[model samples]
Target: MSEQRTHSPQEPQRRPRITHNRKKTRRSKAAAALLYVLFVVGLSAVLATVGWIWANDLLALNKDYTSVIVKVENDESFGEVVNDLKKNGLIEYKFLFHLYGWFSNADDKIAPGTYELNTDMDYRALVTNMSASSSTRQTIDITIPEGYTIDQTFALLEEQGVTTVEKLQDMSANWNYKFTWLKDLPLGDYHRLEGYLFPDTYTFYLGEDAKYVINKMLVNFESKMGDYMDQFTEESQYSLHDIITIASLIEKETDGEDYGTIASVIYNRLENTGAETQGYLQIDATLVYLNGGKVPTEEDKAIDSPYNTYLYKGLPAGPISNPGMKAITAALKPENTNYYYYVLNPETNKHEFTRTYAQHQALVEKYGTANEEG
Candidate 1:
């Protein structure tokens, strides 16, 4: 039935060899699995170390307490911010901060200014401290007096280290400020915003932007003149610009209690264009403006300038100076009077108004004509 096979001792040995090879394969596989586990553990440790460092930087943790001043220039890129932070010891990792900035929109939030940063501030706090409304930024309190010309205002701002005069003048002339009332004003002249800069004390950044500096004053003017603006319309005889121009004249003419009376004289002169004044304002203050803030001489009257009320008719092209609320109110609500001419009396330091040229001449002779001498 079945053929009997002879068994060699070597056959048993070959079977044992096969078992040994299988054992060896199993041992090799176990070794590979242990190596893979060791590799994963090492990689995880490295990642955890890196993550901890980044987290420490982001949260401003465990670092020595230090304070530094960081200055971000106008239009500066975020790279520059990172460099400043790095240089000032405010941050240790520039690349990580940049990534955070990109994700958090820190570039848009951080404004150009001088900031006082300390080790206590986190990355988010640092970004906030550099913003336009930052409490840590340096500020200066300045008082811009009433009747200040735009030049005077700019000079004052420069003196207080708020901004450069050249920058202010440039922005005032060319910048297209977004305000409904400013639409009619044409650009190109620095004096275009003369009457609109409301005179008041303000708190401004030490090195503020020119646009923002000017905008603050303009916004103040709008806020103060809100009620008057509501009363004006397209059908009104005098626009807000005209009223401001008139107010400027009144502001320079007298500082006493004659605001309403002076305003009445101005209206009387303007309304009676056919009268002897011939629509010419004939104001000595305008001549002073033409003569570079000097007391106008008799020759200044003859020099041809649109601001010279003696030479040209109507409101001296624009406002001569910034007016306060009192002057503005007088301009809006002038006293009802029939007087057309006025002369400042030196003895009383008040203006004398009269309807006739002869009366004004008499008063001028008595008062020796104010601010007319060379």
Candidate 2:
């Protein structure tokens, strides 16, 4: 028998190298470290997201609006102009707008003008609109003189690019303009806005409709005359028709308030000539209204309407001009005077008042024929 080594029972059996299990423990430790690192990175990312939200909410932009007029040049670069706006404090955040335009390829289509800008404008839209020759909105100022008839008022508007004079003339006969009071009244030729329209300085936007202008004038009339409608309460004498008729004469006579008294003198003659001879209270103003002629002939006197002082023995049919407050006040409260006839001093625009026809005729002959005044 071969010699067999017999170990003592106290000694243990040794295992192979592959079964040691040390390497396995090391691999597991490495995997756990990697997982821990990944979890830390995810937590950091979540925290950063929360902080960004809070910062954005706290830092909103606030800017005041101002109106400024700018003239754009032909061939000017839009980018250069946007840079100018940022530099001038006219716009906020110039970069985002410029980038948006560059990305969208809309850099060349901006409009330039006096702009009313506020914080309401977005970065991209502000740049897009501010960069050319177009406007978001347009504004204009209109001035209507104190004594303009509707036709004359239209001419003023036409001269200022508001509308054509023909449009106003056409509307006088249009169905819409046929007022409730004058709807059935003929329009061959008539006062467009007599008691209905008012006179005052006003402001308006560009491209306003003709009807809007008419409405504005009417609104003014309502405001000023709302309380004074009953100014002529003694129904037997002072009527609305008479007040407007006298007011129109006052408007034509002079712009001076003092002339209100003189205007009253002429009205008295038209209403109460003191005799029953049926004499005509001839005035050149009606002829001017009818034919735009400076003077009236015997035929103009035969216009044959209630408006004709020559045909009738009283005041004319209606007002000839849009009167101001002074004229209206004078019409309501005429000064007590015995004068009946008057004539205008062409150079002074002042009238000469007299009580008798002979006195008035002498004044007329002297002023009407004497060297035509200096």
Maximum-TM-score candidate: 1
Clashing pairs in 2: 69-114, 110-131, 110-132, 111-132, 111-134, 112-132, 307-317
lDDT for each candidate structure? 0.87, 0.61
Off by over 4 Å in 2: 1-135, 169-190, 232-236, 255-257, 276-279, 297-299, 302-306, 346-349, 369-374
Candidate 1, residue 291: how far the Cα is off, in Å: 2.9
> Against the hidden true structure, what lDDT does model 2 obtain?
0.61
Q: In candidate 1, which residue ranges exceed 4 Å CA deviation?
A: 1-69, 83-105, 122-124, 369-374
How would you encode candidate 1's per-residue C-alpha lDDT over 24-141 as one tens digit per residue?
Answer: 9999999999999999999999999988988889999988999988877776899999999999888889999999999999999988777889987889999999998899998889
Model 2 residue 75 CA deviation in Å? 34
Q: Candidate 2's residue-wise lDDT over 102-177, tens digit each?
A: 8766565554333444444555555544543335534566667666666677777777755456654555445255
